[model samples]
Target: MIETIYFAGGCFWGVEGYFQRIPGVVKTEVGYANGETENPTYEEVCYRNTGHSEAVKVDYDEDKILLIELLNKYYQIIDPYSLNKQGNDIGTQYRTGIYTSNDTQMKIAKNFLNKKQQKTDRKIQIEVKPIKNFCRAEEYHQNYLEKNPNGYCHINLNEANQYSKSHLTPIQYEVTQNNGTELPNTGKYNDFDNPGLYVDIVSGEPLFLSTDKFQSNCGWPAFSKPVEKLNEKIDTSAGMIRTEVRSRKADSHLGHVFNDGPGGSTRYCINSAALKFIPYDQLEKEGYGKYKKILASNF
Candidate 1:
């Protein structure tokens, strides 16, 4: 199913371009939203005090991406605490806001804002309200960055690709960065089950524990659960629908989770290329000695 949401994060060019690269985003358009007048032009919004904020209308597939995930991504691009300004653009049109279409969305947006407010002492200036009106921008404004490669974009489009390219192997990069799956039954840890902690290859954050590992014969290292809370997103790629898991810190794609497992437990079919195992004995040397006691009790 497709759902629509509006985001006003400074200039719409960078916001639209950044979301376009994300998976599950069906379409994006630049427009002026929650304005007073109908069919307001870009010039009117900037100079005529039309009360319209330059926004991006995003239509995303709910089965593939959640609204919260989009909101998280939105937070990364704009300063929620800044009022009527972002980057170098200082104007009402560049003000940040989240316009929702329904009560459910409004609730979610408010809750998200409340949680964010607790994290920082700075007062958030972002407006969270129901979308009152929207007017499509001019032809040149649509996909502006895509059309002009060197166009002025306040957002860093390559922020998602922040990982060091030289550090990861070809398969690791393909799996973690590009969301490519390793060949089944060919991973280094598929058949070799040793006592250790499986960590995200990119972030080195603890993911799955050895105690949770089980033989599922699914051509991947299967675990019943993760040691840490990993991010889960709906994945509708490859002609099949599944829940894709990623490391929370690095946001690197680890693998997919399934309901089929031993004794009614869920299975975390992870990619070995996306993980780095830290042996139990070397846990102290690796600065993960805190988990040594946990691993011992499980063994």
Candidate 2:
């Protein structure tokens, strides 16, 4: 399913460009959102005090990315505590805000902000509210960064690439980023089924539980289900059709899911190179103590 969210982080040029690189983002358009005037132009928003904020309307596939993951990425590009400013831009049009149309989106945004507030002493200046109005910016403003490679952008577009290179080995990067499969029967978790959690190697987000694992004899780690939502898409590569599974937050290509499994359950065949095992004993030490109850219930 496709969902929409409006993000007013700073100059729409950088905000729109950054989200375009995300895996599940289908499309983005620069616009003025939640403004007082009707169809306010970029110049009016900037100089005429139209009460409009330069925002990007992002259309994303929920099956390929979660809303919370998008929010997490939004937080990375802008300073939530800064009021009416982001990077070098200072104006009401450049203020930080999250405008949503539905109750679910509002709740998620509020919860995310609340949790973020608990982590710091400063008050979060980001506005979270229902979208009042939106007017698309001029044609030239759209895809500004793509058109002008040397355009001024406050966001660091290379952070994702840098993170992948610094945190993952060559094989891990290959499997996760390029969808290259590991050799069958050669993965570290192929025959290992200790009590623990399997997390995405890139983002460390909890994925599969050890209790859900079973011996599928498929020469890879197999699980009945993941602990959280996973992004899935139709993969028609190598002359075969399959359902590809990916980590929602990091958008890493984990592996695939198949219908054939024990007790009519679906089998999530995952690449060990895409995951990092956190043993049950080390859950607390690894800051995954909140999941202890989930692991205990299975026992």
Predicted candidate 2 versus true structure: per-residue lDDT over 1-299, tens digit per residue: 77999999999998987787675576789999998989998789999999999999998868667899889889988999999989999998999999997999999999999999999999999999999879999999998876776899989865554546655788898998889899999999999979999988876668999999999999999999999878898999989999999876566899999999997889999999998998999888665787777899989
Residue pairs in clash, model 2: none
lDDT values for all models: 0.86, 0.88
List runs of model 1 lying over 4 Å from the truth.
162-172, 175-299
lDDT of 1 by residue, 115-234 (tens): 999998999999998987798899999978756777999998766454234567899989998999999999999987789898877656689889999999999999999997778889
RMSD of each: 15.0, 12.0
Shift of residue 223 alpha carbon in model 2, Å: 37
Clashes found in each candidate (C-alpha, N, C closer than 3 A): 0, 0
What TM-scores do the predictions have?
0.57, 0.58
Candidate 2 local Cα displacement, residue 59, angstroms? 0.5
